[model samples]
Target: MTARVDSAPADSQAEAFKRLYPDQYYRRFLSQNTRPDGRSLTQTRPASVVLGVITSADSSALIKIGNTTVIAGVKLEVLMPKDPPDQGCLQVNVELTTLCSPEMRDNRPTEVPSFLTQQVDAAVRGSSAWQPQALCIQAGRAAWAVYLDLYVLCADGVLLDACVLAAMAALNALRLAPVDVTDAGNVVAAGNDAMTDGTSHPQQPYALSKQGTPLTLTCAVIDDRLIADPSSEEESLAATVVSTTVDGQGHVMGLQHAGGGVELSTAHLQQCITAAQDRHTDLFRVLSSAQPPDH
Candidate 1:
């Protein structure tokens, strides 16, 4: 009983030390096969997704993984591409503001936003989540351009994963509004008397192709150990980071690797794919639940 009472003070002192030296604290936790946040190396924090957060946009989704939060919104515009007027365009942008993290408090640009935009764009377009040709109003005339915008509300860790998820969910929840294509190659709202010269098209909701939904999961290589769904703190100390995008059919869509000095082995890459597939199962469950019944 006496020894236990004395240990309480020692534990309190250790806690204080951890707060004072976070890097060392995290190392100590990793040495014991755990993280400072009480998660194992391969485990991720609580995640959730909600659709239709922004009423102004055609479709939107808000996703959260632990303290990190991201929201995605889509807007449709009429684009007349020179080469493939039959195929619509996909514009992806990622915005980071002071509201996301202290690093952005100065209002300077960082590489993170562009990197995130590339990852999300590749995952959605490369995976063919929705066929661009389907957006065509008339051959060689006009097509719908999808504007996918992602905003980071918080950046605790695994930001790319959250952003990709939000983008995919928002695109998945998107429903194309009925429009009329005028002879002058202009698109206007359907059933509007102002655009009487245009031909009205039947309302068709946007839907994902037969291809399964895409999900991107991020992993960090820390001290030569692979950890999936790393928190922002862990990502900071990582030697390398890899992101794997997979579909519900367990198909690999895209892979992104950042940072170097430590080369990842083939086995590690395979593990990342496996981890993404398993995580995809869980993510899809959340996405399916968030989808509207009409879709």
Candidate 2:
């Protein structure tokens, strides 16, 4: 026979209990229709975007989604691809260091979400955030390759969402000096635009043709409930995670299972898409308001 206590758990006792029984502690909160972070099942944390944070990079932006922070920097290089000689290329690399999370502190090393880069890459390319034709300096001769590097400075969770926001904001904030091919077969920027290394001066900026910037939402299902923008703690307890990437126009750019092999129902998938679309409205507003050093 079990006896029930009338009094609720003390805050300090609850905290200690959470430390000892993490899974049960978290599930206790979830059973009450909320998360440990105090967010509703469908709620997401606040987000912010800051542009032109890195002076050395061609373009850069820092984005924060709750505690998760990601900084994206881009450098434009000239290249001629074998298949698509005239089109420009976009290379994305995402790195999560030890500073971002305690799990990465040991020498053993921790693997980040393997699909985060793929999700952001698919969204960026599919949406034409950078136009292939615009990247070409001369037809089939020379083209621009955008190297986008994203660093996760904080690891609260919803990593893909933060990374995608950083990448999109950085791409749109790009300001490059006009460049042309010289008689010596060298590409040079217009007057006073290039440094000794032939890279565009950060002061002289030209806007790149960007469209359909992406906003990604990651939802975790636990106890048959969908939770949006789960924190790292919540992610650990999830049965599965589904990421939905959408544009400002509510068009779905990409969708995938980011974690766990557990299958989700059609309704759950639709719910994620809807959440992403709603997130786009707020995030796009923030992106639009970003102020770069130059136009």
Question: If scored against the real structure, what TM-score would every candidate get?
Answer: 0.88, 0.87
Evaluated with lDDT, which candidate comes out highest? 1
Candidate 2: tens digits of C-alpha lDDT, residues 54-127: 88899899999999999999998987655676677889888886689888777564456446677778778888
Candidate 2 Cα outliers beyond 4 Å, as residue runs: 1-11, 107-114, 192-205
In model 2, what lDDT does residue 265 have?
92
Error at 184, model 2, angstroms: 1.5
Q: Candidate 1 residues 148-197, lDDT tens each?
A: 99999999888888988898888888888777777776777676354454
| Candidate 1 lDDT trough over 10 residues, lowest sum | 192-201
lDDT agreement with native, every candidate: 0.84, 0.82
After best superposition, candidate 1 residue 181: deviation in angstroms? 1.6
lDDT of 2 at 260: 65
Best-matching candidate per TM-score: 1
